[model samples]
Target: MRMRPLGRTGLEVSELCLGTMTFGTQTPPEDAHAQMERARKAGVNFLDTAEMYPVNPVRAETVGRSEEIIGDWFAKTGRRGEWIVATKHSGEGLKAVRDGAPISSKTIPETVEGSLRRLRTDVIDLYQFHWPNRGSYMFRQNWRYDPSGQDRAETIAHMEDALEALERQVEKGNIRFFGLSNESAWGTCQWLRLAEERGRPRVQTIQNEYSLLCRLYDTDLAELSANEDVHLLPFSPLGAGFLTGKYQGGAVPEGSRMSLNAGMGGRKSPRVFEAVAAYLEIASRFGLDPVQMALAWAARRPFVASAIFGATTLAQLEHALGAAEVTLSDELLEAIDEAHRDHPMPY
Candidate 1:
């Protein structure tokens, strides 16, 4: 529950951000409220959600339900100012929202307004574009990613247009800062360049997947984050609960994510289980909870602003909260590095 600065925004956020992707779907409204209260009690002041949320099976009908649940909590507790809330505008290919509209000048205002209405908040602490309109290498796309079809000038124009709209949001007090998700180093650089040149809101954070199983950000993006002060808000630090050792030995517990989505969003693989076993062994040897080890490892990274984690139940949330106290020793970190070397990119 340690607080950290969110990029250069001067807004401090908890080291662990409570994720609400399951708030209204797998998790009921009352449970979601209890989770929020529990997290607040644990000193977590940051929450992350999106317009297209409650996503075990993201549905058009359930769209924005997670934010609505959070809004209800805010209304009931009257504690909106106690936390820094971050949410995303769905990008292209999310058919449930705006008919799969790409984020652009026209979409920014309405999307921000919609999120505000659902969250019962006036100004968003961090408004993130869920992904680039052109596309991204995240979500297992790196295996077949190709950028040859991209139009550089067109992409730059889109960035400029989106930044302009975001600047207007800043002026009108709709959003205080802007961020990106599922973006690449080059894409982030362009956003930073445009903001510097135009004096728009700086890209404060990059909320990408980073964990023991996913080290995609350890190279260029890590350097970019360190040098530019655009810290990372790593989502899925537990590898979608795979790192929690729940999916081991092919045991698909009922009501689990793997039970709902058999593939776990392409994360289930022979190599992945091997990687999980290796990390789990390390945790067992060190007498640590695997969930806390994985989350603490992600939070300990130099470029991480916060590690975003989701829990489907209060017990799961309490388990993750223990990570705040589980500090990895230098020897344990080295063991994790050794395991990574042995099983890199398991998924």
Candidate 2:
């Protein structure tokens, strides 16, 4: 895997980041450890997780189990320093954590401590707020998104408060850099602006959903990322297994994401299948693996720091790692663009 700069933080990360959302749930502890070891050997140095994870149906009982699994791996292998780990602080509406509390000054310190304890690490490489307290347009929310109810002054105050809290964490050596997830362009700009004005830690990355079926970040957020150097850590780069062609032809394989969550987190739609078919056809025509094509496509985006991908099994992870060597020809890229024009906002 090639290394890329994580925003302007001067920390280099792998082009592909291993996602651990399935580590403690669908994937067993031994499998999770093996995946981490396999990824490390494959040259992946970045791992992303969240406090409220192992989600194929995120339950309160299983919360933080993913981190614990990773911590076990770190303890057993004694290879904590070999990778740059990134995890998130759950924002408002996640009832499993802090009773659905929003991220604020009160939450940062304890949250950081909890993650540190679970990960068996002293400091986090990238600590991300899972989402803004003001809400976000991600996760298929764009269709009905409304910004009219937002309070500008209140939002700015929250950003300042959060930044101050994050700065304290930095000073305490609890976290080295800060990031955001499921945030909008305006929200990201405010975070950056506040950090600059207040002399707090600047936002280094934004982990949002970006894939062949989801191009929501291609416009204003893309522009902001390019101009400000707030690189994107795109999750679901394979469209939540859709782009892998596993969900094609309306087949819901047992133990698949769609089998567990019928709606696939609102990613299921007739158009989504059509979009997947388009990309799969392109891959078939070029004699390429669809999974590698989708992942490589996301990793090759100009503003991407890393394309975060999750694999429920070792076979899946090995197939995904092949993307590191599979470069999209210019012709293949143009074909993908043409298909995107034909089927935009698939989900």
Compared with the true structure, what per-residue lDDT tens digits does model 1 show for residues 217-301? 9999999999999999999999988998999988999989999999989989999999999999999999999999999999979
TM-score of each: 0.99, 0.99
* Residue pairs in clash, model 1: none
Candidate 1 yields a Cα-based lDDT of: 0.95
Global lDDT of each candidate: 0.95, 0.94
**Which window of ten consecutive residues has the lowest lDDT sum in model 1?**
241-250
- Give the distance in Å from residue 220's predicted Cα in candidate 1 to where it truly belongs: 0.1
Those runs of model 2 whose alpha carbons end farther than 4 Å from true positions after fitting are none
RMSD from true fold, candidate 1: 0.6
